[model samples]
Target: MELAISIIVGFMILGAIYAIHARDILSAVIAGGIVGYSLVICFLLLKAPDLAIVQIVVETITLIIMVAVVLDSSRVEAYGKFDRPAWVTAGTAVLILAILFWFLKEASAPLAPFGENSMRMADAYVNGAVEKTGSINLVTGVVFDFRGYDTLGEATVLVTAVLGVLTILRIKGKR
Candidate 1:
């Protein structure tokens, strides 16, 4: 399971890199979707079904919005030009790689093994959720009652992103 998760994470990183470096806008958008789907898989592997579902839905909507934007744009694809010198770019990449490697190495040591459910917060939520929020479903209660503001903020952000994308596409249509 750990190996599977590691492979998925590797693919996620690859997708992110591809999205950033892709010459074509359409390819970049597709790569971004790949990264988002990979995250959903990661959430499932971590035993968070609710998070996985939410991620899948968000990813699907994001992909649709991005594709709509791309299709409505005048250019089918656009390539970005790097103005920095090759050596400077290479040095920056190397530095970033080194920092990432160090951080991964330090963070890879697991605090708890898989299937371990010893968290105090989990116990508290499981025990008190129903009484506190008057909801039979603990997850739903926690999300809607305990952390309702956070959920609302997330929804707001999603709506803002969709509106921004629609505004850009609409402005492009005028031109």
Candidate 2:
């Protein structure tokens, strides 16, 4: 799993660099979207499905809006030279990302194997969720009752992202 994540991170870095160095706005946006969607895969690999779901939703919306805006605009920019300082900055970013990845790997070293549940809370949720939450569905109870605020937070993030994009796309005179 770690190996897979490392490979994905490599691609993620490449995508970000391509996004930065891309000459055209549309290509840059597409490359940026690659970086984002790659993150969703990383989240899933790390056993964080909730985070992956939210990330994919937000990334898809962002990618669509950016592509539409780039296509709609008539702006053109001359290709810019990649100076030594810019290269240094990119290198620094890569170093930071690498360090973070190392930290993530170390953090997960003690965790149980993939597909195994090591969480103490899982036992509690499974045993008493139905009676306590008054929900016939265990999944529903866990999401809405035991972890209500977390679920709300995820929903809020999705809604806020959508609304922000809509606001930016809306016409000045339109409500």
Clash counts per candidate, in order, are: 0, 0
How many backbone clashes are present in model 1?
0
- Encode model 1's per-residue lDDT on 90-128: one tens digit a residue: 999999999999998889665566667557788777876
TM-score of predicted model 1?
Answer: 0.68
lDDT, model 1: 0.86
- In candidate 1, stretches whose alpha carbon ends up further than 4 angstroms from where it belongs are 74-84, 96-119, 152-175
lDDT of 2 by residue, 45-103 (tens): 88778788899999989888788888989546686566668879899999999999999
How well does each candidate superpose onto the true structure, as a TM-score? 0.68, 0.55
Best by TM-score: 1
